[model samples]
Target: MALLKEASNLKLITFAAIQERTENFSYGELDASNKPPPIQVKHLNNDRITGSAAQKFCLFRLFPIIFSDMVEHLKSFKIYLILREMLDIILALPQRKSWLPYLETLSINFQCMMLELLPDKATPKVHYATEYTKIIEENGPPLRYWCMRYEGAHLYFKKIAMQSYNFKNIPKTLAQRQQLRQCFLMSKCRFLKSYQEASGNKIIYMHEIDSKVKVLLNHRYGSQFIQSQTLLQCSQLIHNHVIYKQHAVYVYDLEHVEEIPVFFQIIHILKLNQEWIFVVDLLNTDGFSTKLWSYRVSSYDRLDIVSPNNIKYYHKGLDLYKVDHFHVVNLTSRLTKTN
Candidate 1:
C-alpha cells in the first residue's frame, strides 16, 4: 500500500483540453482527495490572452485588438508574433479558399488603414510580413519575438520545458515511449490533414498523388519498382505545374523505415531547380514519423519538433495546422497566396 501510494504520487497525467474548457476542473481534480499531488497542468489557451483580464494584465499578448490599443495600454511590454507559412495557414484553416479573402480584408482595412495609417500616406505596404514587421519596429524590439514555423513547435517547447522546469523525463520503455512519441508526432500531422480537408484543398499536396501511387506500386509490382515510379510521377507533376519550376521539392521518410537512399533520389529530382527542398526523417521511435513527414511538406519554411502534451506554449503556431496523420508539403512562398 505504501509502495502503491508512492507510485501514484510519482505518476502525473495532464490533459490540456480539459483545462482549456475550465481551469476549475483542473483545480477540482487536483483537490479531490489529495491521494497524489496532482500534476501541474496549464491549458494556455490562445484565446485567453485576448480576453478582458489579459488586456489589463498582459495587454500585449491580446489578439485581434488594435495596435494602437496595444501601444496605448502597455507602454513597454514584450510582444511576440507567431507566423506560419502562407500555404500551411491555408491548409490549416476551416475554409481554405476563404483565407485569401479574409486576409485581404484584414490587410487593407484592419492592418493598413485602420491600424497603421498615420496622418501622412508614407506608411509601408499592408502585406502580412510588412505590417507585422512595422508593428514590431515601431513598438521596439519585441521582448522576444520569434518567427517560428508551426512544425517546429515541438522542439521549441522541449527547449522551453527544459529551461523553465528542468524537466528531464525522457521515457524509458522503447515500445511505450515509441507510442507516446508517435502520439506527439502524429498530433500535428492529424491537425494539418483535417485543416487541409476542411479548408477545401481537394489535393492537399502535389506529392500526395505520387505517394499514393508508390503505396499501390509496392503492393502490386513489389518494392523494387518504387524508384522508377517515384521518379516518373515526380517528373510528370513538375511538368504539369509551372510553379514546380521555381519551387524546390522535398521528400521525407520515417526514421525507422530504411529507405533513405530512395527518398534521397526523389528529393534530388524535386530540388532540380535550385529551389529549397528539405528531406526529413525521424530516426527515433518517438511517434514523430507522421509529423516529421507533414512538417517536411507543410508550407512552413522550417520544421519544429514539439510534444503534443506541451502544445499550449505553441498553440498559436501549432493549432494553425490541424490535419490528420498524413504528409504535408507547402509549395507557396507566402501564407496568404490564393489558388
Candidate 2:
C-alpha cells in the first residue's frame, strides 16, 4: 500500500487492479487454442518476465481477455487496445496486402497516443511501430520473416550454458546435449510431427450415439448397419499435439468472405476408417462483443462430419463462453485483412 501510494504518478491503482485480475484469471485446459501456457505477468510490469518469446506472445494475445473489463475511459488503456489491433495484424499468417494501410494507421495512432498521454514514457519501441507498414510493403508480411522459433531455440542453449558450469569446449557440450535431446524426442511417437494423428480413450457403441448424428451417419453410409458397430469416441481428441474437445468451437469455413469466419462445435469426436472425424454442429456468428472480446454465436441443429485436415483456416479452436444466455468465441485474429 505504501509503495503504491508513493507511485501515485504511475496510476499504480489501475495497474494493481489489472495485475490482480490477471493473477485470478482462469480458463479450462481444453481452452488451449494457440493459448500459451499460463504465466503470471503481474510481476512483468515491474520486473523482466523470464520466459520465451512464445510465452510473451501468448500473454500478449490474452491481454484483451484480461483487461476487457478495465476502465475503458482511461487514455492509456486505449493505447493498449490499439496495440492489440497491431498484434492481430502482425501475427496473422499469409498476411494480406490490404492490411498494410490499417497497420500503418494503427501504428501511427499508437505512437501519437503514447506521446499525448504519457509524454515522458515514449520509448524507442513506439517509434519502431511506424516502420512496420513500410517494411511490410517492401518485404511482404513481416510474419514471413519472423524469428520467434530462432529466438526460442536459443533459450535451450542459454539454459545449458548457464547451468552446466562446464567452460571447456562449451560448443561441444551444447552440441552433445542437443543431440541427446533431439534423439530422445524424435524417438517418440509424433515428435516434430508432419502428419495428422488422433487419440482418445472413451468408447461408445454406435447405437448409443445421438439419434440425430446416428441418422446422419447412417444416411451417408447408405446403411443402418452403422448402429451395429462400436465407436471409440472421446470428449477430447489429441490431434497432432493439439487438443480438440467436444463442445469447443472451431473455424470450419474460410473461403467466402461473407461466411469467411464460419465456426462449428464438435458435438462428438469419433475415429473410423483409421481417420479422426469430428461430428459437429455448425454455429452462426451473431455479432462481436467488444466488452468481452468474443464473438456471440448461435448453434444450429444441423450436424456434419468433418476431418480435422479439412479445416481451411486456423485449426486451433476457441472454447465457448456463456454470457447472457449465449455462447461466445474468443478468436485470436480475424481473417478479414481490414481488421
Best by TM-score: 2
* TM-score, cand. 2 vs. native: 0.77
Candidate 2 regions exceeding 4 Å error are 1-20, 28-52, 158-170, 180-194, 222-229, 234-247, 255-260, 323-326, 336-339
Clashes by residue pair, model 2: none
Model 2 lDDT tens row, 1-339: 112222334563455554565456665445443344433435435544444566566566555555454334344666767877787677676578878889999999999988987766687988998998988778876666879767869989999999999998999999999999988887875756646544456778766878998887777665533545787776676665667877778876664565357789888887777667888898888777765556788976978988877665564767776655767777666555234
Give a tens-digit lDDT track for model 1, residues 57-94.
22221121212112223211111122222223323312
**What's the count of clashing pairs in each model shown?**
25, 0
Please report, as a residue range, the 10-residue window in candidate 1 with the lowest summed lDDT.
Answer: 311-320
lDDT of each: 0.28, 0.69
With candidate 2 superimposed using the best TM-score fit, by how many Å does residue 4's alpha carbon deviate from the native? Answer: 12
Q: After aligning candidate 1 to the native by TM-score, how far in Å is the CA of 306 from where it should be?
A: 32
Q: Kindly give the stretch of ten consecutive residues in candidate 2 with the minimal lDDT sum.
A: 1-10
Quote each prediction's TM-score.
0.19, 0.77
